[model samples]
Target: MRKEHEEFVDSFEGQLPPSIIAEIKDTCPASVTKEQLKEIVELTLGLYKHCRVNAGECVGLVSAESIGEPGTQMTLNTFHFAGVSEMNVTTGLPRIIEIFDAQKEIKTPMMEIYMKPSHNDLEKVKKFAIKIKEVVFGDFGAEYVLNIFEQSMTIKLNKALLSERGLSSKDLAAAVKVKSKGFNMEVGNDFLTFVHKGKPEEIRQLYDLREKMRPVKIDGLKGITQVLPVKRGDEYIILTLGTNLEAIFEYPEVDISRTMSNDIHEVYNVLGIEAARQAVINEVFKVIESQGLNIDIRHIMLVSDIMCITGAVKGITRYGVVSEKASVLARASFETPIKHLISAALESETDRLTSVVENVMINQPVPLGTGLPGLITKLK
Candidate 1:
């Protein structure tokens, strides 16, 4: 460990070009010693570790709070799969009901129907269902059955779908969009979509309703919030939160905590590399400035890497030679904790001295030595 620390110090020293070191020494008057440089590096690394760890916790907290809040909804907009076209249908509650109704007649009821170019046509499928109903129970009977499917698509008083249902915008406190397999919809400015699951008539009705309901405008939605607890399985997964300012205000808990977590996560997503780099630089500079020390910027960069390489916050630890080496050097030069203690003591002494001087100015005897004569010979 000692050898490695020596090598680390040597390597760092070697990196600093002689000219820069000389210039710093010349400018600062106190030459940059190997020990001082090491201390600066170690301090820089420590700061980096602290920032990263805090950043992760901050992100996690924000994600949990955003998802736990009330009044969130998730939209899943979908499109057609590959090698398939022409039978395109928008996803909505009404369409799902229609599909469920058409399948109800079949014994299996859970049959998966594959649609080819013409076969996939939603309008054609609806017509086919209508014809099938007509053959079995006549025109009036077919109409009654179709009406049932249509009625199922209606939104109930509790704000849930009456028919083939999924989560609605109102049911959730916020919406989170996760990227899924094969031609999934991108997170966008509108509602989510899913594949049409029912007959043409039902699909059309759902699409119409979706179109009629204006897209929920999410104003000033800073970003998405995601929470993943440390647990087995999928015990707690709060996926996404919408950026609706009004919704957030109505439920401030979600906005402040959960949404903020997501936003911080998003920050990592958007600028992790840059943030990490800047964090290192900032920390190194702070250590150098605070200690009244002079060190090369590149040395500070090295220290930053040591501290932040793990992207975790950490305090100074003995296992790391940088911290240990720096501490030893600082102790050797300044008598471990003594210099600070002495400085504090000196400050108190100075205050006492000032008080004595003020008393003398007022024609009063100073405390102790001030009032007594320096030469007093006692007659034994």
Candidate 2:
């Protein structure tokens, strides 16, 4: 029975895609006769041929319209991530703009860090989550006392904050001492005293020192602003507010295979351009899905392909994918027409009028679809 299916798949090798062929073979049951399987394959091939786009189709224009039409319905509201009120992510139209523009610095950079099976215990994952949170001095919930007379700054650390971060008073003192110069650190039960060893006339430095202490990162990975251990399915995963892909990948317990950052540029830098391309598609689809729209995936794939065709991710903006067009008129038609025209004129460039926009500007049929072919007649 398996041999019969294999023979059928082999006979339709070039007609059907490898993936479709494999699916048909794998999904067909032994109870189904050879004739039924052949009929199913024939129907699938017919649908595939019918759905395929014709040559010279203006796919770029179609894709733009497909995405833009649905984009009008998207909201401008931000959404709470995974029911975590503390973390709000930009969504709807704004997020779509951010993705398509290929913005380097996003509003809310985040990471979904999956854990290895060996370290996937609830308590262990919780500990791992806290271990990566960026513990700045401000997070300590410390009360500051500034004394100009003695040129001393004292910080009364909250015991709860200390225990949660797994830092002792001595560790805090040592961290402060290492961060600041010419300061004598005295560690007590729940407080640390910093006495400046510099000139007494520099008493104003105490105020500066007090303010500087607020942002001091005493422990944990840098750029990880907040961490939440959330259970997805049967495994516990860590979701972070800020992204630090390089540092996060260094951890042993992290399932590096499945871990990914929401920052597309970070993914490009860390995992290369291919991953960035996939990230673009995924991010765009996520926004569209969240808005309750059901656009075809092929349109999204086409957009991503254009963005990553140059071996680097470029946005759909004038300065990005638009600027790379071969036709001067096509570039001019997009934005800043006078600027593009003047630049081309100054550079002594020629407009071949190869694409749709350029030919349309000249009152000629677009070089696409039925207009793609030229008719030549020999006069008698």
Candidate 3:
């Protein structure tokens, strides 16, 4: 762009990418002094070069070892909100593995919900959080009772809860009526009853219905059980204990751009593979940082790259990425050597000895950097 910026960039000997240079240039003021630009350029280049690795670093192995070493030091326990919250979320080492493995159903799925600017006020946020928190019949009901003689189930609702949730008994009855029309419903102040059309002698059917109704999402975002609003720097955000990425976005007041689900697969489903890659990196770093441990971010980035390189998130286990290696020997070397060898032999597979693992297995010099040089010459 500017001669001053262009000259400064040229001083790097073409090591810095054009994108980085353009970004620095664009962000700088038009009237910025050449001396300031020079200092910035040098600092940026120095940092970049410092982060760059040597040609034969064997990044994958180094990253695995680096991350794993720290992982052993991590707490294996999950976190629970102290009694009052009545919720538990998987965190620490287990969570780290779950994120890396891209497990379909996470142990403790969670979400960070950001509200639209207009709806971020405390009152609105609180009300919205309440509206989205999963409310089951058991939660608001003071008591759950079975009437075998009448083939009915009745719940005595807490009046204060109804008032607090801005729901009347009629509203509650209407919701159940819509979902379960097979019941003869009666609505009154602080109580509701349902008489199943099925015979009273069908006791097992009634018990099954009781269990089903315990998790009936009356009104709220499904799966979101607890919501806590936290002040982050200058803004407030809601942290939820459960995740339902698809349903939460339906709310018009949610800041769709910023709200995120901690469940990696959910992120992949909603945002695609690239976003899932970022989530893995962010989540790993988050765990390590929280425990007051600092590891090279490059290692974390490399791990994220490997897991996401397949265009879908897969674990670093035998059933996942390890088994999917192009080299037959490479797969064998990971674990269960005989099984892999036998399976490969049955299929008449060939090991080209292309990768480090396969080459090393055959006692050949692994082809990395200098190992790639096949010919030697006399300097005469």
Candidate 4:
């Protein structure tokens, strides 16, 4: 920025946050005179002051109402699969509930895998996508024959499928050997013969081994069941059905900085608390926007801030963010009132009634807005 612009912006440093002032300086046109710039900064400062919450405003309640009211209008549709073959994704109210409750296992964990610029070509991206999808013995198996007379299991492999997956019959035999213990394996041109080494009376073990060996992962990262390489604007990116952020980050061709996962806990584990907080905001906003709700972003931001304030991502449920409340009544009012009351009684806890719910429970005004100030009486 110019020296004059810097000086002008510096004048409003204390009045406004440094970030806001810097934004104003960066946004203002250089053709404008110092007086014009001053006017702009003052106007921005005035708007900022006007938008700020009052000292005693009940922000939590307001945010709750703002988010909760519109939330009821959301659709209850669970899986809105775009196409017959496309992956199913939990959407609308169900997804919102999943997000707020911070469910460890989500219905559908999806990821958008962006590639580095050089590796985003059509063929390369397609190959990368295929390479990342979890391939099992079942995917390559052409035929399975169980011979009870000989107590042996013969598996025929599809050469075309194996070649497409960049695997050979030897790879399949090795996998079967590792997975199916106590079985003598012999690799042929495009087939494997497993002779049961266990007792002949336990012939059922061969059939069991055949079924178990079908799902063993022979190639690609685990948990990635499906991958689709799509052209997004000028770049090609892969959309996956499952999410394994930590495992996926190990790929050199992946653009880790731009990749995103729908699983909030996975994001937290891989990228830390801040990224998880942003993920919450983005996911919530996405649902709200998809449902055509016009709620303000600040309310969502406040909720996200509260969820992430303790240096971890927590849900809005009783066992999560609500459990951290200092007030016993506030915690009780949320859920399991009797349980909270009993616990408080056992601990010999005192309720000062400093907050809203506890004060309301006793028919007293909440310590907010007009009730914030206490009257001082002078004795003669």
Q: Using lDDT as the measure, which candidate wins?
A: 4
Query: lDDT by residue for model 3 over 1-380, one digit each (tens)?
Result: 57857777666657897878777877888777788888888899888888778676687888878888888888987666665356676768898888777778888788999989898788888888888888886677788788878888788998887887888888877666666566777777878887876555676766676666666667777788788887676667888988988998888999999999888888888889999889888888888887777789989888888888889888888888887898988888888989999988999997777778777777889877687544243345
> Where's the lowest-lDDT run of ten residues in candidate 2?
371-380
What TM-score goes with each of the models? 0.18, 0.87, 0.81, 0.89
The per-candidate count of clashes, in order, stands at: 26, 0, 0, 0
What are the clashing pairs of model 4?
none
Tell me each candidate's RMSD, in Å, in order: 25.8, 3.4, 4.9, 3.2
Q: Model 1 segments beyond 4 Å from truth?
A: 1-153, 157-206, 211-380
Sort the predicted structures by TM-score, highest score first: 4, 2, 3, 1
**Number of clashes found in candidate 2:** 0
Candidate 2 positional error at 332, Å: 2.1
Which of the predicted structures, 1 or 3, would earn the higher lDDT when compared with the native? 3
- Which residue ranges in model 4 land beyond 4 Å of their true spot? 1-6, 17-40, 78-84, 374-380
Q: Which model is ahead, 1 or 4, in terms of lDDT?
A: 4
lDDT score at residue 46, model 1, on the 0-100 scale: 59
Quote the lDDT for 178 in model 1: 19
lDDT of each candidate versus the true structure? 0.33, 0.87, 0.81, 0.88
Best by TM-score: 4
